[model samples]
Target: MKRFFIGLTIVIILGLFVGTGYFLYQKSEEPPIIYETDTPFKTDIIKKTIATGSIVPRKEVALKSQVSGVVEKLYLEEGAQVKIGDLVAKIKIIPNVVALNNAQAQLQTAKINFDNSEKELKRQKELFDEKVISEFDYNQFLLDFNLRKQEVEAAENNLELIKEGSSQKTGNVSNLVRSTVNGMILDIPVKEGTFIIESNTFNEGTSIASVADMSEMIFEGKVDESEVGKINVGMDLSLSVGAIEGVIFNAKLEFISPKGESDEGAIKFDIKAAVDLKEEYFLRAGYSATADIILQKASDVLAIKESNLIFEGDDIFVEVRTGEQQFERRQVKTGLSDGINIQIAEGLTEEEVIKKL
Candidate 1:
């Protein structure tokens, strides 16, 4: 019975060892890697770089106050369309006590002078009529009286201007702010009763409103200094606004700054392009936008994905599938690359399949 048990144990241990060996052998085998392949095709390749900027009006005008006063009334609100000579806002001048008193005193002194001159003129006239004075002498006194009368009127008008924003002689024109250019009002920083200082030698004054012509808009953006040298004025641009989606606007490059400005550690050159605005769509000023500038382009050329090309020292080469699961390295000449697909200039045929890796 002991011998039969020993034989049974040996058989069981051998069976277990055989099953483990079979599982290990199966695990060692793996499926062969079937390399994916792609063929060259005819397509248009455009090499471009992106620039960040905002859309702004080509002709923007900031209307400022000419006199120190309060914003008494506003004729137009933000986004209101206006034409040349249109009323925008009205300023009610707040007179200074010293200036008003001086003007009043001047007017009073002119009146006193006029009264004395009138009395003198009457005496002279009576003397001339009675043949007691020459006609020339009477005429001279009359001229002096008239001159004094004119001075009094002028002083009174000056006093009125100092006390009030508008005078009878100047009418309401001085206080009424008018638009100098035909445009839509973009902003009105001041409201009713807001005190504002006039533009003088000391200050720039207060800006009442900013108006711009929407018909003529431009994309003002900046590009990195490295890319700026490749771009020149008059190149075409395709722009996309962040607020307005799925639409691309066409623009023509008009200006490029000769100087570079440092922004966030990167030197950038300011660029401007005239946007061709569509009548149906209104582009508000300062809309954030991205511009894609085409540096080079090739149409209907043989091209392949740039990933398939392997860099070997200074030359570029790709693996072409010669047979099943097989490839041969082929050196190829390249042309314009849009950073994704590159143009295959030479040493490769469209019929040949290239390995993706």
Candidate 2:
């Protein structure tokens, strides 16, 4: 039995040795890893970000009218060029009863006083001519009579104005709301006979005119908060206004709001740019535009594929081909990269081949 047990142990040990040898042979049969290599040469690299927005006039003025009266006539409509002092709208004033009554009472009192002053002046003049009164007294009487006559005229003018918007001296009952600034009529808020209220200290009345200097336009758009910080005033920009097709207008960043507005749960900063309208395209106010701001640029620069670069502690490296079938790890100095390519400032030459892995 002892002999049989010893023989069984020998067979088991022999099987274990064969298995170990087979495992070693399988490990030695594996091949060495060969990293791929790529040659670095001259290439143009450009990095840009695309932003979507609408083209808007750089300087758009909101025109509003203030008057409480019926719009008698709107002489102009949208797309009409108007000059300063040009008639825009005529307001028909429906005299308020309270105002009219007050004006009439004031005029009646002034007329009565005028008659009394005129009789007194006539008596004083007769006395002075007959040498019954001194020249100084007659002069005083004449002054009083002139003052009353002026008062009567002023009172009448006021009365007429209260009954009608304009007096005879002022020309007509129509209140001519003229254009204060020279520009195009962008909008007409009121139609003929449309009642409007004059802008008063208490309240902002109806808007009669929407005018702006159409020639001077501005681009109004928003930039993401992340990008807004990189942009500064006077940065160059290229814009494409959606309204006028196939047109590119040059612009400059003018204003950036310090405060951010929360939009759809994301913070966004408002930006205003002044577009240089060299092309003379009809850029309507509030037209959508997208702007490409060229923040920084470098030309004829030494660059390489960005993906080829590997990073270690305080060091950048890449695998370059030292021979036809050999690759060695090489340290490199990189500069501005447009993502796809990086500026190879150092550690690699134009003729060197870099291993992608």
Candidate 3:
């Protein structure tokens, strides 16, 4: 019985050894790598740069006060359409004490002088009728009376202007602020009873409201200094507004800044483009937008996936599949890339299959 048990144990050990050897042999073998393939095809590749900015009216005017006063009434509100010479707001003049007093005093003095001149003219006319005075002397007295009468009228008009910001002789009132251009009212910055300064040589004055020609819109954006050299006037741009979804507006470049400005340690140049507005959509001023400025474009050209390209120092190459699971490296000349598909300017054909990296 002991001999039979020992022989069984030896056979069991031999079976375990064979199983371990087979597992080791299987682990040492690796699966063959199968490469995926792609073929060059005709496609449109556009290389572009992006600019971020806002949509604004090409002509925007700030309505300012012509005379200093307190706002009494506003004739228009935000988003209201207005025409040229339309009343926007009315101001109540707060007359200066010194100026008002001076005007009143001048008017009083002129009236007294006029009363004396009238009496003297009447006396001179009676003497001339009696032949007691020469015609030339009577004419001189008449001219003096006319001059004094004109002075009185002038003084009255000055007093009226000082108190009311207008006079009877001038039909228009200075305190009535009017729109200088035809546009839509964008903002009303002041409220009732708000004091405002007049626009003059010394000060810019307070803006009562802002009006802009909404029909004529423009895109005002800034591009990086590195990309500005590639763009020029008359180029086309596609605008995507943040507020408006699924709509793209077309624009033509009009102006590019000759100088660059620094912002956050990087230089940028300002660019303006005329937007072709659509009648169906009303674009308000100051709408945030982004523009896609095409730097270069290739249409109906042979292109391959950018991932298939391999770079070695100054040369670019791709692997061409000559046989099943076989590929050989071939140098290629590439042009405009939209960051996904690249244009194969030379060294590749649509009929040849290239290995996908």
Candidate 4:
């Protein structure tokens, strides 16, 4: 009975070991990699380079103040539509104390001169009427009186302008800052009560607002310097905005920077393209966008997936499926490739099945 139990235990242990070994062997064996095959099809091949950029107005102008003063009033807000010569803001001129004093002194001097001229003119009139003075001398006195009166008027206007940034002579244009272009207001950086400087020869002045022609927008992006040489002005660009999905904006290449900029230790060139926005679509400025610039395109050509092509030293080839799971190496001349489908210029037919590498 003991021998029988021992023999049964040995048989069970041997059977378990054999089964475990067989399972391990099967798990270690990898399944065959079934290479997929694709047929050459008639398709358009567009060789393009991608550039990351933003949608901005072609003409974005920063509205700056012409006079230094506190922002007394802002006529427009962000996102407001504006036209050329529209009043954008009112700057309360904080006149210089010295300038104000000088203007006041000049005004008083002109007034005194006018009063003396008036007395002289009256005396000259009396002398002329009495025939005691020559006609030429009386006329000279009359001219001096008229000139002094004019000087007094000019002095008053100048004093008003220096003190209040406006004068009676100038209409609503005084202290008023107007838009220089027809566009939408993008931003009003300065609020009412904010002190701002005027744009002058010494300083660029404080920017009150930024306006842009939203109707005429452009894609401004940078591309790798290596790809810049292939692109030129007037190339077609397909732009995709991140914020505005489901719509592709069409644009034409307009300007490419003659110089390159350094980013992340790589040289990149700036590029600008005019965006053709649809009537139903309203694109806000500074929207992040990506553009695929078409460098070259081939129409209705026999093409295959670029992954199907194999490269050798100075040559490109593809394996054509001649039989079941059998492929024959054939040299192929390739043309345009948009990084996906490659145009087969020669050595392949539309009906031929090629093995994917």
Candidate 5:
């Protein structure tokens, strides 16, 4: 019985050593790696750069008051359609005290001069009728009297303009703000009783309203300096508005700034594109949008996923599958890349399999 127990213990020890050896051996041996493979396919690859901006009216006009005054009435509101010469707002003239006083004094002086001239002319005419004065001397007095009368009329008109912003002879009120262009009212910046300054040589003045031609719209955006060099006038752009979903508008590049401006520590160039507005969609001013500017494109060409490419110093290569589980490095020339798929310009074929890196 002692020998039997000893034999059983020996068998158990030998079994334990065998199990440990097998586990260590399995851990040391790694599974073979199988690389994924792909083939070049025909696709349209477009190389583009993105720009963030908004849609705005190409021709925007700020309707400003011609005379300084308080806004008495608003004839139009935001989004109202207007034509040229349409009354936008009525301003009540707030006449300057000093200017009013001067105008009044001038009118009084002109009236006194006219009255004196009238008496002299009457006397001269009576003498001429009696043949006491020559015709030429009487004519001089008559001319002076007419000139004085003209001065009085001028002074009266001036006083009326200061007091009421209009006169009978002119028939036009300067205090009436009118739309100079035919378009929609984008905004009415002033309300009733709001005092505004007149647009003049000294000041740009306050804008009473802003009007714009909604039919003609432009995409105003900025692009990074690195991408601006690749773009030019007449290039096509695809605009995607943030507010509108699943709609893309087409536009053409029209203007590119010759100089760059700094924005948030990055140099950016301003770009303007004329939008081809659709009849169904009414694009409001200042609709935030993104533009995809196409720099280059390849249609129905052999393309490979950009991730499969391997880059080295001044050269690019791809892993071409020579046989089963076998790949060899081959240099390839690339064309347009849309940041996902790249055009295989050379050294690649649609039938050839390539390892995906």
Candidate 6:
């Protein structure tokens, strides 16, 4: 019994030694992951959103003809600078045959009556002066002669208007269409022989030309409904044109549409920005541009890489390096964030080291 007990004890002791050796060997084979700390640097960070849009002129004017006629001449072409009262085009008369013939017949009848009445009036006046005619007869003859003369004049004026565009008294209405304002001719829609209709009270007729004051330019863009409420008139804006890259122009918010429209489930508000163009930069009408309105700015602030920030519920935390092998999660207060970088309002200073990745 003593020999059996001693043998069992030896076997148990050897099994324990082998188990301990296997545990130590497994731990040594595992790989280790290490992280490094970075020295904090001073930098400026701003949060902004990007929007895409096009540039448009501050004002646009469309010129239209005033009478229905064939175009006789077009003095100004596209991109022509013109002043007020400059003649743009002329219209040649295309008479109505039936109306012209009627006017001519009326004129001949009026002339016959006017001549005969004048002769009778002269004889009657002489007889009255010689005491051989009554005063009533002379007055009647004088009235009849004046009526005939008026009819003759009316017919003659009508005939001249049908043959030409206007009589001597009604000067030429077809010879000129003077510009109403000073501007550059942006477009000329009519050729020399193109027919045009007058813009009247009932309808918007054909457009003859388009003129605009190019000196005044504006930026038209849209902002998401979420950001629209934050903007107001007179706010400064930074703009970049798609065609003119690497340059940014400054502007001010001039208009905000009170209404909003839904686009692809997102509500958007239209905004107009008035560009303050320098004498060197002449902004052409309808150039595409992107505008950035600064909502907030800080003169001097301590900021950090945006990726370093972590959130738990509503609170923000950052991993602060404590020692070569130790780190702790720290709570921090934050201010303005410009998307790429964020301002560290509390729990950080310029000399503190941080982990970037």
- Tens-place lDDT per residue, model 4, 159-211, is 88877777787654457888989889998888899999889899999999998
Candidate 5's TM-score reads 0.92
Error of 5 at 286 (Å): 1.6
Per-residue accuracy of model 1 over 1-357 as CA lDDT, tens digit each: 999999999999999999999999999999788999999999999988899999999999988877889999999899999999899998998888899889989999999999999999988888999999999988999999999999998898888876666668657556667899999999999999999988878999899999999899999999999899899999999999998899999999999999999999999999999998877788989899999998888999999999899997999999998899999999999998988899999989889999997
Which candidate wins on TM-score?
Answer: 1
Q: With candidate 3 superimposed using the best TM-score fit, by how many Å does residue 234's alpha carbon deviate from the native?
A: 0.6
Cα misplacement distance, residue 249 of candidate 6 (Å) = 1.4
* Candidate 6 lDDT over residue span 1-357, tens digit each: 999999999999998899889989988896865776655456655455455577666767887766667888888788888898888887765666798789889999999999999999999999999989889988999999999999998899988876666778767664367677888888788888887776899979878888888888888888899898888899888899888878898888999899998988998888888788878776777788988888887646888877888889999988888887567888899888887778888988778777766
Q: Per-residue lDDT tens digits of candidate 2, residues 1-357?
A: 999999999999999999999999999897867777777767655555545666654445554444467888888889999888888887777778898888888889889999999999999988999999999989998899999998888888888776666677767644678888888988886788788877778877788878888677777777888788788899888898777778889888889899999989878888877778765567777788888877667688777778888888999998878777788888888877787888887888877777875
Clashes of each: 0, 19, 0, 0, 0, 3
Q: Give the least accurate 10-residue stretch of model 4, judged by summed lDDT.
A: 165-174
TM-score of each: 0.94, 0.75, 0.93, 0.83, 0.92, 0.80
lDDT of 6 at 219: 83
Please estimate how well model 2 matches the true structure, expressed as its whole-model Cα lDDT: 0.79
Clashes of 2: 19
Better of 2 and 6 by lDDT: 6
Error of 2 at 17 (Å): 28
Give the winner by TM-score: 1 or 5: 1
**Residue 314 deviation, candidate 4, in Å?**
3.6
Best-to-worst order by TM-score is 1, 3, 5, 4, 6, 2
What's the distance in Å from true for residue 324, model 6?
2.8
